[model samples]
Target: MPRIPRTKSKTGLYHVMIRGNEKKNIFRDSEDKDRFLEILYYKRQNGEFTLLAFCLMDNHVHLAIGEGTNDIAKVMKKITVSYVYYFNKKYKRVGHLFQDRFKSQVIESDSYLLSLIRYIHYNPIKSGLVNTVGEYRWSSYNSYITEKSNFPNLIDKQIIFMMLSNDPQKAKQLFIDYMSKETQENFMDLTAEENVIDEKAARLLYMNMLEEKKYKFIDPIPLNILQEVVSQLQAVTGLSIRQIAFITGINKNKVSRILRKHSKLQGD
Candidate 1:
């Protein structure tokens, strides 16, 4: 069966997960994790995307990202591709460093958004990698609580803090309390799903909620027609319009117009 197409977000806020190939280890040591973070920082500086929150586990990684000048897919590709290259070189072994495709879930609701932040922060604890979230040095949990500037672009602390408390300091403290042992809440739990269909349905439902505001395709074209154009373009070029525009420095609107025109010409 063909896979369902990925639904893109205009504003680019996505909860992304990249796991090791075949459930293998992505990080051999602290150096590997640090290298990944460094690549993330470099991508942010290049204005590819903004990292809202992130957690680096031994076998997988989680990130909440807001699209910046580039789409999330491209941004992630650059980060992962570069890291894989370095990883292969350092270890003198290679095939695929990460799973074929990273998993992404759009965050649609304020409640789910908050839950995601908590979920990501609590990953290490849930995995038994650490007894407390704060004990995990690779995650953004402490940075979110302390207002530290180490990861300027990795997390949008303002949003989380604002949600937690009206006062930033109070919010930080509240977030800390939530992650503390006293809370007894398990945020990292995954939902039960019988199969891929069930999981995809759940993901779509979650993504739709995250995108509550109606966004017409970046082009003013009708929805069905626009999708057809996107399909044709992807089939021929193996590139998303967003990715093409980012690489070529063309306006996304122009790319959409070109694709629409090309589609019309073909039909004629």
Candidate 2:
């Protein structure tokens, strides 16, 4: 099945995620994480990308960045390839280090931009790896709050600062307060949307699975049962089979076959 091409962002900003192969640990130690960050800074200096926010996890990395001269894909390719080469050389191993392709979402609005930054910065805390975002040394939260110049990483702080307060000190205080808050209703809401999308994709795949199993008869199925299944799937995922198949590389004909078979079973 052909993979659906990802949509590029017109504004050049994206929320990107790259995971280790099979969700294995990506960072072996502080050196691995530091090397990745160093590569990121090098790329930024060469005008390949602009780092907004980032979080390095054991198995995955999240980044909020603006594409510079290079597109998001190109930027990611360069970063990952360089890091993978270094990692393999260091660990005395070979082959791919990252998963098939990185996941990305175009930031379409200011609200989402801020939310994504917070989400990325707070990943360690949210994953139960840390007690607080500020305590996560690998993330950009320290730089943002402390105004530390050690990293030389570029971040658009004015937007978030303004959202907090007009006064710089007050803005910093507010930003800290906001991040330190234990509640994550906003983050959970955003995650729910992704869950819905995943559920829909899974249901479509299940239909494809049925077709692969080759259920004997596909005709004379009851419409009501088929409709109920599809409806339940839609309610959970908010996507139609067409959309799911398009994204997931499932055959539309196979999906139809499964639906038809289920319909007949319900009728009987």
Candidate 3:
């Protein structure tokens, strides 16, 4: 079957994910990780996108970017192909290193944009790579805090700080609050986002709640409870839109919308 076209971002910004091909480790050690970042930095300088945030993992990477002189596809292709070439040459390996295509979710609204930033930065903590946000040296989190950025051309921190407040210091402090572990607990748990779905169990949970509420597709849904249900259902399983619609009688569009709204799933 032909691939469905990706949803375009009006804001030209996205939360992008690039995983290792076949669930393999992309970064075998600190040296590999460093090399990947170096290539990423060079590509960032090429002006396809503005880097906002990033997290390098054992088998994947998360990048927050705003479209610049080039589109997302070109930006990612340039980055991924180069890295793969380097990886292959160094390891004495050939063929795909990263996945066939990088995955992305548009970062449109300011609220979702901020949430996505926290989500990306929180990746290391979620993966047990580090105990604190500061401990993770590979992420762009520190570039936002320090006066002189470690990655001068690699990250765009001004936009985020501007979103936080008019005052620079106050904005930094707000970002500090937002990135802090204590603050993350107020909304979503980092690990909870990593929940793997059990399909049999998930179908039961959805049915039980629907039956209890006697919810019908035509009936007005309580947005709060509906969001909660969608989140729980997603956490427990990786059900497709059609599968979810089949169970809830809510239709594919509604299921897709709900999942998109609470899109804080597992990290890259």
Candidate 4:
């Protein structure tokens, strides 16, 4: 079947996402991330687009951008190609670095635009990379909150800030308040919604495992059972090590050790 065309953004604004091939880490180190950002900044010199927000996770990236002199496709192509070349050269690898076609959703309203920005800013938190949005260094959230960001002019915050309030300080405060709220609001994303298991489900999995094994006591679980429990929690529930530890009352380090050992055993 032929490919479907991307939905055209009437307002020339979109929420764009791209990930590494097979869900691998795109930026191996800080230098790699810096280079990618450098390319992103360099591409904008032509005035082809306006970047509003961005978050660089290990394996993927989220961008809120508005088309100016060129379409979003052309803008993304320039940015991705430049970075991929640098990435492949540095790693002494070849072939595609990015996955299939980049995903995007049209942002035609101010409400949706603000929500998308919030979601993009919150990506690191959602992925358990950082506990707070302010703690993450690779996002545009700091740009909105601070006047002295590393790349202050890379993103255009005027429109979003104005929407929050006429007063700059008040707008910043409001933006912070809005971000602080716990959100169940969903938006377009590459990861399937079902893939992320919540705390309740994770705990249920642990409880059910103990009951199945006819084990009454939670503490001092047999060594073999502990390994199986940790490995199964990861394999079956897809919960992170921290989450698994929380659910099973296991030390996070022990959980990591179990998974690593299990993986090594499987490899052998």
Could you say which candidate leads in lDDT? 4
Overall lDDT per candidate, in order of appearance = 0.66, 0.68, 0.72, 0.78
Best by TM-score: 4
Over the stretch 1-268, how does candidate 2's per-residue lDDT look in tens digits?
A: 7876776776788878888887788899999999998998888889887787888888888888899999989999999999999999999999889988887777654445655676787788768888878778888888787756446345657656786569999888767765564433232222222311223235344455435445211222244544454444444565665644433233456445655665586699
Q: What are the per-residue Cα lDDT tens digits for candidate 3 across 142-260?
A: 88898565555578888988987899999888888767733231111222222122233555677566557776322346877787787677667767776565444454676778787
Flag the better candidate by lDDT, 3 or 4.
4
lDDT of 4 at 94: 91
At residue 189, candidate 2 shows an lDDT of 24
In model 1, which regions exceed 4 Å deviation?
147-153, 181-268
TM-score of each: 0.65, 0.66, 0.68, 0.70
lDDT (tens digit, per residue) of candidate 4 on 1-268: 7876777877899878889999999999999888988887877777988999999989999999999888999999989989998988999999999998788877765545766687788888888888998899899988888888877878888877798789989878877877675543455676632222224456666767866777632234687888887788799978788667645555567788899999999999
Model 4 local distance difference test score: 0.78
How do all the candidates rank in terms of lDDT, highest first? 4, 3, 2, 1
Worst 10 residues of 3 by lDDT: 185-194
Higher-lDDT candidate of 2 and 3: 3
Q: Which 10 consecutive residues of model 1 have the lowest summed lDDT?
A: 192-201
